[model samples]
Target: MTDQRQDAIPDAIPGAVPHTRGVRFAVYSAHAKAIDLCLFDGENETRLPLNRTATDLFALHVAGLKPGARYGFRAQGVYDPDRGLWFDPSKLLVDPYARELDRPFRHDARLSTFGVDTASLVPKAIVTEDRPVAPAAPRLPKGGLIYEVAVRPFTLLHPKVPAALRGTVAALAHPAVIAHLKRIGVDAVELLPITAWIDERHLPPLGLSNGWGYNPVAMMALDPRLVPGGMAELAATVATLHENGIGVILDLVFNHSGESDRHGATLSMRGLDNLTYYRHVPGAPGLLVNDTGTGNTLACDHPVVRRLILDTLRHFVRQAGIDGFRFDLGTILGRSPQGFSRESETLRAILSDPLLADRVMIAEPWDIGPGGYQLGQFPPPFLEWNDRARDDIRLYWRGDGWKTGRLAHALAGSSEIFSAHGLGETRSVNFLAAHDGFTLMDLVSYSHKHNEANGEDNRDGHNDNHSWNNGVEGETRDPAIRDSRRRDVQALLGTLFATRGTLMLTAGDEGGRSQQGNNNAYAQDNALTWLDWTTLDDDLVTHTARLARLRRRFDVFSESAFFTGQDGDVLWLNEQGKPMTTADWEQPDRQQLTMLLKTRDREEDRATRLAVVFNRSHDALAVHLPGGPWQDLFTKDHVFSPVLPPRTVIWLRELADPSARDKEAGES
Candidate 1:
């Protein structure tokens, strides 16, 4: 077929756009000699060569081609792999801007082989018509809780969820799911990667599949498996969440694509323009920069890549009304050959863009590259995952020495790290556990990672988890061991909730979901990873709910400002109720401490003081209070005897007394 192009067509906008006459298909490939728009009609294939309308763009307008048409691209160019050129006309390429995929990507050896016709192997990109949803502001509160969720595993075995909607994005809108989120007081749900992804080439050989959708191929296309209804389903789910006072934050992976290393699949970007889409060694174009530990890192500094990322973000915001985004391996976004910078062009663009300015931006601020651990370096308006807090909290609860100061630092919003620029509020997304590591229950039940099922010989996950088994490792029938583990989990949860800054809870962690001690259960898509809602620990769920309510009810728990010891804003006290001196903080075996804070009781609309006592010892400790008329924050019982249970965190609030009320006000 002869090339056809119209000067009126906007070549700058890459992707298939349906218009009055037909569909306008455009793709960007700086190095391709020629590109073909391969249309699929059942078993028949029609190849139409595209005209090089722009310097680096191919464009064509095909009449009668409508929205629901399945198509792929094939580029005919130099086929040198050593010099970073992988143009093979036999390989079918998905559109970089594809909004929908006809099927999920299936990896095969032929996909990476040269001269292999992969029209049947690769998933076809479907031409879709855009239906923009009404724009709305983000719904995440400043210090709200973000519940990290993997779509399929979260609802796959949920007894209340419908069978048909068990593992789909549409199921998130179901009343059962929403009720669970509301019960745990999840202000926002950070859905893990829902984009179309191919299994790691190594997985299918081992009879395993990628349960976590971290490996992405199509950046914009919603996975036909996870999101069956495409953009419409996601948009509707977001609307439903917004109606229930919860927000939706997509956990996006832009650091790398599923194309993997040089031996990886010849997918869309790699075939279209490998040299342009990915970062390569300066002297050796064939050598890719493995910054993300995911084969190849995206050349995010490139103009083409920057535009694609921005366009993708805008599309989600405009079409789905998405509230925010949590960037996985986020350091890659601001990295260049010179290393990472907070003022990178892409970071600036996302911050300056009118449409994205108000959205919540969170960064998983680390990768495997040089200078990748940029914990507190992200600029304002971008909250970062604080691994420091996670490790310190775990170490403290594991009966480590001299961790009291570290725990205090984390609980107070980690001022030393976040306050370097003199910022009053912390930009930390504090959490005890996340999707990448052990669940909350496992943190107190497993001493070491039990990833035997991952086929990697248990060397995949974190080595030093800073975890401890109460008495016995793994699951035990001993009631004492079980009760000890439960108490430790509750204490950890209480510590997380009482900490200052934004909070994040992995889905099912509130109700004690375990991965059989497998910290890296990314490949176990079966019952091992699925959350068994029927057998969830109801008492733990209740404890989590109460913690959530306490966090919301007391303005102190949500305060963004850093606490100062002056004026009773905050005080670290010993078990004797006196200000903790250096000797007390340095006590290696001391596991009991009190955190006193001046706060406002929102329920009573009165200013009151709160004391959070933590005891990690095996024996209950008697603690003295400086103030009178203290009551249990959750139980509402007067603190007749100030004694903390073993491995427990007790919250005590000063009761309102007419006699001492005015004196307390005067002192403040």
Candidate 2:
């Protein structure tokens, strides 16, 4: 504990003295005639009575308050529940917008945010002042590929990552990890929830924790367990990633928390002001609303909760240079009192906020409530995780046809689903695999999900995985069958890069990472999920790099917005460059889909094109070129394969030098 002047809003950034020195501090406490900014100075309370004009703004401008000073507010007001005004002068309340906190509020009886002795069955407040300043981590977004990762097991046993840095945010900035990401061409790293959270009681006893990070307790603070030197080390990591042109994004969980159902204890929100933060049943005074498959859902419709969400977001952006945020179960953010509204205030605030306006705000897009599947309905400037694209691509490649039309729309950025909302191709965050379901290898090797490792008796995880086993269930002794499976996995990776949208590949998908058959590896935190860096499979590594390199070379394949018109930027054609017929799209066993992605070639000042032929059937198919001299980028040859074998994806790029390949062929 140290003594500090208590006059202004403290700064959270290092080196720079608080610009808010001598600035006023205020919070809306309408009932409190007198409010005190209880500054925790040197183990003593340096209390300052706030000078107020109106009841709405409880404010004060006194001296000696600097950065790192732990403080809370005490207000005097009527203790009531039905009318929604509960203020206890003896209780200490944290500022809803505080940039930093000493320690997270312990879920003890003493620190209830709600009033303990209400006239009725009202809530109570947890009166505890913060201590020590917790530094804030820098935020990230921009010019990066965000790889969402679970924090705890990311580097728990990596030989390169220091034992001290393991399992923490600072660990991500370790030299070895950073080098790996750079080597793989990853631009951004998105961490799953780092906010303080409580484990689900049911999971805690079984050695399973909330690995997905769907539960959150502290919104503005970093999880101490994942921070070595605490927020300061986390903050340093941000600066480091930014120096390397990489960005960071958090998997925010504002939908629900560990506190669930009507029987949960009164913690932060339930103890402070239950009605203000959580959605409740209409007539039941104590029955809380649940929608996130969790016990309760934070009501984004409420004024306080809305303000809390906005303040927390703005605080992170200001204190840290974070480039973006990825919202888990984000559909709940669009819900209103009437129902889930696309034009809800929560959504409106995110768009209008100057600090977050240009940030990479991505939504999980679906929940467990009614009309919860708000896939393509998110407003503009938002990226949605396109589960439809994931499933369709998997199904098509497995030879489940009569689906070519829908696959085309997805490959072209799902204009059918998002164009009406004024969004383009980049709005869809396309991926063939994510952490929630099966890995790319598992999707091709196992038709059924093997989630017994999750300890839920295989009852958990999605049943309709849109997968194929390639003639065998587990391992196969047949060489031909094994080769086919490996090729299909490569085809899926190629399609992910060739698709017109923001591509999100799971960490190990590029190298054919597998979990044996476990679709849900959330709890497996072992060799099953950790990337195997030891395997030196040169061909597989080269193939994955080739896919990423192709995406980097051709803008049309990775363009933010898909081009319209037959000759614009992309084209869907049959074998002979003609319109695809219903029979062609519906042919179940016919397994070739040809798509041409065109881009503006700067050197020649003309549009360059790349034709990708995806052959998925067991038999070979002859694909005709779209009436042009195409160069095979790999071999620098003009010889196009008229007949390509099954489970293969061939890419041919139009070259600027007409004689580039001819000269090479002559030399050969």
| Most TM-score-accurate candidate | 1
Candidate that would win on lDDT: 1
Candidate 1 residue spans exceeding 4 A from truth: 1-6, 657-668
Model 2 lDDT tens row, 1-668: 11133223343211112324443466544345466666665445657776544324455554444555566666665555444344566566555444445553333333334445221221111122223222233332222245666766666656788778776788788888787666666667878777766555556456665555556665766655665354566567877887786777777888986556554433334433555567777776456677787788898877667877887776566555677788898889998657788899899998898777877788999998878999888887788899988888888887666467767777778888787666555588888888788888888889999988778899888899999898898667699877877898878877776777777767666667678888877666566676665643456667877766666666564456656865435677777766578877776655667887667554455567778887776778877875466666555567665787777788887654534544665799
- Model 1 alpha-carbon miss at residue 289, Å: 0.5
Q: Using Cα atoms with residue i matched to residue i, what is each candidate's TM-score against the true structure?
A: 0.97, 0.81
lDDT of 2 at 90: 57
The residue pairs in collision within model 1 are: none
Encode model 1's per-residue lDDT on 29-115: one tens digit a residue: 889989999999996899998887645678888998899999999999999989999999999999999999999999899999999
Give the lDDT of residue 641 in candidate 1: 62
